[model samples]
Target: MKIVQSTWVRYHHIDLARELHEMGHLERIFTSLPWWKADKESREQHVPRGLITCNFLMEGVRRMGGKLPFYSKGTDAKLAVIHTKNYSKWIARNLPDCDAYIGISGSGLHAGKVAKSRGAGYIMDRGSSQIRHADRILREEHLKWNLPWNPVHPWLIENEEAEANEASLITVPSHFVKQTFIHQGTAPEKIRVVPYGVSLQEFHPVQTPPDNCFRLVFVGQFSLRKGVPYLLEAFKAFNHPNKELVVVGNVSDEIRPLINSIGTEHVKFVGIVPRAEVKRYLSTAHALVLPSIEEGLALVQAQAMACGCPVIATPNTGSETLFSNEKEGLIVEARNPKALAAAFTRIADDLDLRNEMSMACLERVKMLGGWRRYAEGMVAVAREAKALVLSTQ
Candidate 1:
C-alpha cells in the first residue's frame, strides 16, 4: 500500500513515517518543518520518498513574530488555528495519489476530503483527547483556578469535527481518548486506539538512586492542565524528610503563583531539558508523577517505565493502558490531592515496594514493544481503512 502522512508539526508523525518506510508502504510525508530540522538519526535511516516542506514562508513569519501580533499572550492559539487552515488547504491542493492518506487532526479536513475524492482512504490521527472534551475540561479547570479560560478557537473546532466526519477512521493514542470521542457522540467503530511507544535505546535504566533521598520526577509543562496544583498539594502533604520533587519542564506563568505560594524548597524546577536528558532523570528517580487531569496517552509514562521508574499517574492520563494499579505503579483519581498524596506516601514508605514496582515497570514496557509495534499497529489500521474504502465502491 502507498501511504502519505501529513502534519503541521513533527510530533510523532516522523516516527510513524519511518515505520511506514520500513514496511515499504510510505510514499511521502508532508510536514511544515524541513527535513534538516528532523532528528539526525531518523533522517539518516529512513529517507522518505517524498518530503514536502510546507512552512518555509511561515517559518520566516514566525521568526519575525508575525504570530505574536502586538506582543499578545494568547494570540498564539489564534495564529495556530490560522496555520492549521493553511496547512489543510496546502495538503488539499497538493495531495498525492496514494492508497491511504493519514493526517493529523485539526489540519486534515480539506486534505481528507480531497483524498476521499481520489478513492484513497483518509485517516485522522488525533494525539490528544477529543477537542470538545479537552475544551470543556480545560475551561472548567481554568474557571476553578480563577483564570481566564481560552477554549479552542472555533475554526480549529470546526476543522476537527469536519475531519472526524470525513475520515474513514480516526486513530487515537489511548482508550481514554477513544472514550472521550465516544462520549462526544462519535461511533465506537470509527475510532482506533493505538497507544504510543518509547525508545528503549535512549531510555534505559542506567542510574541507581542515591541513598540519602527518595526523588520524584514530573515532566511536561507545569500548568493547571497537568494538575500541577494538585501535585504541589500532594507533595506538600507528604511528610517525608528525605524526599525531593524534580520538575523537568517549564513553569508556565499562570502556575507560577501557585508554585510560589506552595514554596519550592524541596522542589527543583529544572526547566525544559533536552529529550536525551529526560531518561537520565527518569533512571535516577524512584517514581515519576503525572497528575494530568486531561491527556491522551502520556508518552512519558512509557518512557519512565522503560527507564525503570515506576509511574504515579491519574486515570485521565491513560496510564491504566500502560500498567495496572499497584502492579507497575499506582493510579490515582485526577484533581484529588489526598489520593495523590496517599500514593506518594505508599511509594516513599516502602523501599521494597518501590523496587518491586520499578522491576515491574521494565517488564511491562517490554510487553508493549516500543515504537516498532506502534508503527505496525498503525499500518494495520491503514490497511483496514483502505479495505473499508474499497468495500464501499
Candidate 2:
C-alpha cells in the first residue's frame, strides 16, 4: 500500500501526507516548501523529515519573482508555468517505487506519465474547476462587470489539461468542480468528489448559539472573484438597526474602489485576522456569507460550519453539497445582491431557525470529523485506482 504524493505548496496536501505517514502508507510526499518551513508546518503531526521531499528551487524561484521590480500578474503567470514544468520533470526523474502516485494538478503531468508506465495509478488532485472551464467563466464574469480581464496563460491551461488527460483518476474538492471536468468532455466515472474538511482543533463550536446583535461575517479574500462587491451591495440593502458586517481577509485591489463606492457604514473590514480571531468572529456572528462567483470548495464555509456558524453561500462555492439549503443555512444565487440581502434578512429575522441551524452545523461537522475523514476518503480513491491499474496490468 505504498503511495507517492506531490504538492507544490502546503494547501491541505501536507495534512494528507501527515495522515498517510501515521497510517504507515506514505512512500514520500513531494513539495515545493523549503525544508525548514515544511518541518515547522507539519510539526503538529510530527511527520518525519524523511517522509518529505522538497524542491527548494521552486520556492527560490517564487521568492525571486516576488522581489523583482517588474513583478506583475504577467511575471507571476510566467513563473507558474516555469515552476510547473521544472517540478514535474524533477519528480518524473526521481519517482520512487509505489503502488499509487497522487499529484496536485499542474505539477504532475510528466511524473504521472512515469507513474502510469510503472503500473502505478496516477491520481491528479485538482482543488478547483477544470482550467478551461474556470478561465472561460471568469473571463465572462470580468467582462460582464466591465472590469479589466486577462485570460489565463495558455501554457498553464494546456499543461493542466494534459495532466487531467494523463491521470487514471481525478479528485476534485466538490461536485461543482466535477461538473466542470465532465463539461470538458471527461468521463464522469473517472472524476471523484471529495469535499475538504476543516481542522477541528483550530475550529470548534463555542458554548453558545448566535443571538443578540445581528452580525454578518465574510471570510476569505475580498476580490471580484469572491463576489465581494455584491456582498457589499447586499450588506447595504439589508435592513437591520443593530447590524454589523465583519469582513475578514485582505481586500483585493480589484474590488477596492467598488467597496469604497458601496460605503462601509456598519461594515468592519478587519483585513487578515489571526485564525483564532476568525473562529471568534464565526462563533459569535449570526451568519457567515460567501457570495463567490468562482470557487473550488471555499474551506471557510466548512470552517465556519465547524464553529457552528450558519453559512449563506451560492452553489458556485460548492456550498450546496455540504449542507441542506434553508436547513444548515441558505444557498442563494451568485452575483445577485438582492438574493444575498434576502437570505441575510431571512436568517436574522428568525432566532429559532438560526439556533437550529447552528446546532445542525455542529452535528454536521461532527459527522464529517476533520482532516482524518478527508484523508481516508483520498486513501479510498487511491486504493480503487491502484486495484484497477494492477488488474489491467
**Which candidate number would show the highest lDDT if scored against the true structure?**
2
Alpha-carbon shift of residue 89 in model 2 (angstroms): 0.8
Give the per-residue lDDT of model 2 (tens digit) for 1-393.
898999987887988888888888899989998888888866766788878889988668778877788778787778778888899999999899998999998878998888878888889999877889989988987887778887889998989988888888999998888998999998999999987878888898664533567998889998888888788889999999888999899988776777788788999888998767778888878888999888888889988999999999999898877888978899999889999999989898888999899989988887876888888888899988887777878
Per-residue accuracy of model 1 over 128-219 as CA lDDT, tens digit each: 88998999999999888888777788877877988898899999998889999999889999999998888888789878777899899999
Clashing residue pairs in candidate 1 are none
**Against the hidden reference, what TM-scores do the models get?**
0.95, 0.95
Backbone clashes in model 1: 0
Off-target runs (Cα >4 Å) in candidate 2 are 207-212
Off by over 4 Å in 1: 39-45, 49-52, 59-69
Cα lDDT of all candidates, in order? 0.85, 0.86
